[model samples]
Target: MRRDEFRKAFFDASDRVHTYAVWMIRNREDARDIAQEAFLRLWQRCETVATQSARAWLLRTVHRLCVDRIRQRTRRQEVSLSMLPIDSFVDADATTDWSPDGDLRGDVIRAVVALSPEDRAVVVLREVMGMSYGDMGEVLAQPVSTVKVRLHRARKRLRCRLEPLCEKRSVR
Candidate 1:
């Protein structure tokens, strides 16, 4: 494809790419950086990557970059980005339907943050990104059957973790 075509495609895909990166990495600045690099790589490999599979290629690139960033941070002993402060949702300027519920939403966010990276990524791709099993498999580099199993296990694990919290709220 030509430069103009590549730029258009990049712009078209950039928003979702950034969102996925943010969901996976949990830091706005880092997510932006990762998305930038992913797009750069996409440009670098544009001729190599098939036009029909560019979205999957872009997402897979972003995912790989996120994993690398996590590892680099780990080696440096930096706190995990996924471990955000509970007050992250306590904004007075924000409006959420769960605002009346106080800490329940925060608690759920915490539970999700506590999940393993792979589980978290699977959950985000399936639930947050609303990706199909085949699409998810393409991005995750797993078989469709493996993607289904992983997503199933991730959902079950999340449900198990969230159930007690829900029950407590219900009891109140």
Candidate 2:
């Protein structure tokens, strides 16, 4: 990409790239790193990257980078709340049980974090980022059908995971 084109792409995509990274990684600092690295890679591969497709390309690169960092976090024993076993995270310290009386947003966030990273990625990309399935497929390197299926499954899992909490609220 020419410098001018690259500049335009950067200006248009920097916030989106960072938002996607933050959702994937759940750490602003790390998200910034991923955004920077992805942009750097884009710059290095500018000759091959099409300016018209730069946003999708940047998002895909950031996703892969986030996955790699997650792997490293596992090795270093700093796995995210999202990677924790649902049961383990829910029952940590055994100090309390989840109830509607507790903060609903916190409970929802905890449930979301307990999902598999892949599921979380689809959810964030499609739902949080409001990307169409085709766009999500491009960024995630999945076929459109696969993206649809994964998103459906993730929603089902989240609904099932949160059902009890919802039930508690309704009962009250």
Candidate 3:
């Protein structure tokens, strides 16, 4: 594609790409950086990336970058418990809907965060990105059957982890 057309495609896909990155990373600044890097890679290969598949390519690129980032962080010494940032739900902020009252939502977020990176990515792609199994398989470079199995296992684990919260809500 021409430079102008490539730029237009990048701009058009930016918002969803950023949102997906943010959901995967859960940090605004890091997400922005990841999205920018993905776009840069796309720009470098603009000739090869078909317009129709741009979104899928971008999504997959961002997902790979996130996985790499997590792996790099893991290789480094992890943050100590004492060094971890405080949960700010102490007072309502637009950042999260998780209040003391919405403990279930908070718990679910924790569970998701605790999940393995691949499992978490599959769950986010399916649930948050609303991608079909075939689309997810394309983005993830896995078979459709593998994508379905990963999504099913992820959902089952999430549901099992959140079951107590559901029961508590029902009791209330």
Candidate 4:
């Protein structure tokens, strides 16, 4: 594809990419910055990345940028809740009534957030982005086998952490 075409592709995917970033990092402003930087990187490397899968390339770019930003920020000091912009979603009313235990949803979010970045990426890509393993592998630049292994481990950990919450709902 020509440079213009590549630019167009990046623009087309920008919204989804931004949403993915927000979902992964849980910061709207940071997500916007990540998406812009990813597209900028694509523009800079347009020639080399011309024939690569656009979706995968954009995702990988955004993911790498987010990771890098996280690492750089961590080097400065300890990470704490104060670092995250207060998200309005947390104040929103509960979405599900099925969790009679009264905090199952919050528990699930905490379990997910507790995961390491790599494991969290796997879970988010598979579950939230709805990417197939092959596409996820492309985005993650990992073999499908490795992606599957990571996904399995992530899900196992999530299940272990969430089981009590689920069981509590049943008991209630």
lDDT of 3 by residue, 1-172 (tens): 5556877888888987887776666566778899999999998998898888999999999999988877776799655242112252123554465665466666766667667778888987877678899999989999999998998898888888789877987898
lDDT of 4 by residue, 1-172 (tens): 5686875796678877986787667676777899988888877887787555776899998899888877877798645453343232244564544242347656766677677778889988988689999999988999999999999999999999889888976898
Candidate 4: pairs in clash: none
Q: Please write out the lDDT profile of model 1 over residues 1-172, one tens digit for every residue.
A: 4555687788788988998887777787898899999988888877788777888899999999999988888899998545445454346566454453445777666777677779988988887688999999999999999999998898899989999988888998
Instruction: Mark the regions of model 1 whose C-alpha exceeds 4 Å error after superposition.
Output: 80-96, 100-105
| Model 2 Cα lDDT, one tens digit per residue, 90-129 | 3346545554346565567676767787999998887668
Candidates in order have lDDT scores of: 0.81, 0.83, 0.78, 0.77
Against the true structure, what is each candidate's TM-score?
A: 0.85, 0.81, 0.81, 0.80
Worst 10 residues of 4 by lDDT: 82-91
Which 10-residue span in candidate 1 carries the lowest summed lDDT? Answer: 81-90
Indicate which candidate wins on TM-score.
Answer: 1
In model 1, what lDDT does residue 93 have? Answer: 63
**Per-prediction CA RMSD (Å):** 3.1, 6.9, 4.0, 3.5
Q: How close is candidate 3 to the true structure, as a TM-score?
A: 0.81
Candidate order by lDDT, highest to lowest?
2, 1, 3, 4
Candidate 3: C-alpha lDDT: 0.78
Residue 120 in candidate 1, Cα distance off native in Å: 0.8
Q: Clashing residue pairs, candidate 2?
A: 1-46, 82-113
TM-score-sorted candidate list, best first: 1, 3, 2, 4
Q: Which stretches of model 4 miss by more than 4 angstroms?
A: 80-106
